[model samples]
Target: MNASEGLWSHLTGGALFWLTLTLVVYTIVDRLSLLARRNPLANPVLHSVWVIGTILVVSGTPYETYFDGAYFIHFLLGPATVALALPLYENRRVVLRSLVPIVAALAVGSAATIGSVIVCAAIFDLPAMITISSLPKSATSGVAMGISQSVGGDASLTAIIVVATGIAGAVMATPLLNFLRITDRRARGFALGLAAHGVGTARAFQVHPLTGTFAGVGMSLNGLLTAVLVPLAASLIGG
Candidate 1:
């Protein structure tokens, strides 16, 4: 009993603490999202980020120290990303058949995402750096950060905007989709992944496996497409 207690203390009081806390909190948030029918406003990733970030700030924990533990989960992000290939490969037939729509959605979605942000920022007379950073708000966080840095924008602001965009997309897309009568799982999933990124994909998974798989493909493909296109567009627009 004493040894067990000591071991628990060693871990929870050490580098595993933050990691454990994050997983536990996220698990709870995920369950809540599930109960709430995977609504975007209650997105697990968004909630987890906000909740965890607040705890870190209020507790005055240095991000670096917390990262020591958090890095384990962070490292798994790459492997999890790679794992999306499983669903994509399994659904290759569906993907091949829908190639035209997929391509069209990516092109239009990416352009609209970038265009709308830039235009809104311009109308509001936001700073060039802010407008540039906001350009990738629809992309996944990792890709958005890269785009922000490449275009001389604020990476931190980009992260915040990306999260907000994802939460909003995840929340709003479902109703819009239902209204549009787009019941095709592939289309639904693809749209979610394209517009909302990871959070949308997560929501898609909760709805159905077929949706999840296509969402994974959309998320991965869109990331690659945006990473390449945004920089060129930025340069042309003088961002």
Candidate 2:
């Protein structure tokens, strides 16, 4: 409406604010990665997202406008998810042999993921949105957001929590696994991805390609299961 607002919006690509920030942040993260020690916790995607989010908040840019530009990046998520199939194929025999355990683990893990969040929220008397947001922290962003929304959570918050949880899992999984004496590649991979999603899969790849393959398998399947289960779980709880 005002000249300052008009000029700022125009210069900022109006609704595409998030897109510009995403690119800029990603570029910075890429350079930093090359110029420093390669740390899994310093993940480019996670770091870029944080930088972009911080700037948007500081600038008072509405999340809706930022999401407009950010939505373009989301389109790639579908293809990237599908591409995980290649890794899965590379480990097909092991996958088949371990299908039962994987499914069982995923089922129990999914329940734990949602249950722990909900129980903690109840114990702390957290608001409904925060409680629901944590329910999908172990899922991929797209599926997690859907599940969050279905359960009366704010999808954007769910996205942030999902990313944060994945990063934390990626960072700590190796040491934790070692402590637990869980050295089997397939089991480690499955557990990490089931609990941590994409970041865990990326960390798994750092150790071995086979581990990455199984991690990818766990991440993709769990995402699907979480999407369906979250809503159903909410309904049952509410009922």
The model with the greatest TM-score is: 1
For model 1, the stretches where C-alpha displacement exceeds 4 angstroms are: 1-14, 37-40
Predictions in order: lDDT: 0.83, 0.82
- What value of lDDT does candidate 2 attain over all alpha carbons? 0.82
lDDT of 1 by residue, 159-231 (tens): 7888888788788888999999999998999989988888788778878899988888788888888888778
Clashing pairs in 1: 40-171
Q: What is the lDDT of residue 192 in candidate 1?
A: 91
User: Local error of candidate 1 at 198, Å?
Assistant: 1.4
Give the TM-score of each candidate: 0.86, 0.85
Summed over model 1, clashes come to 1
Error of 1 at 208 (Å): 1.4
Model 1, CA-based lDDT: 0.83
By lDDT, the best candidate is 1
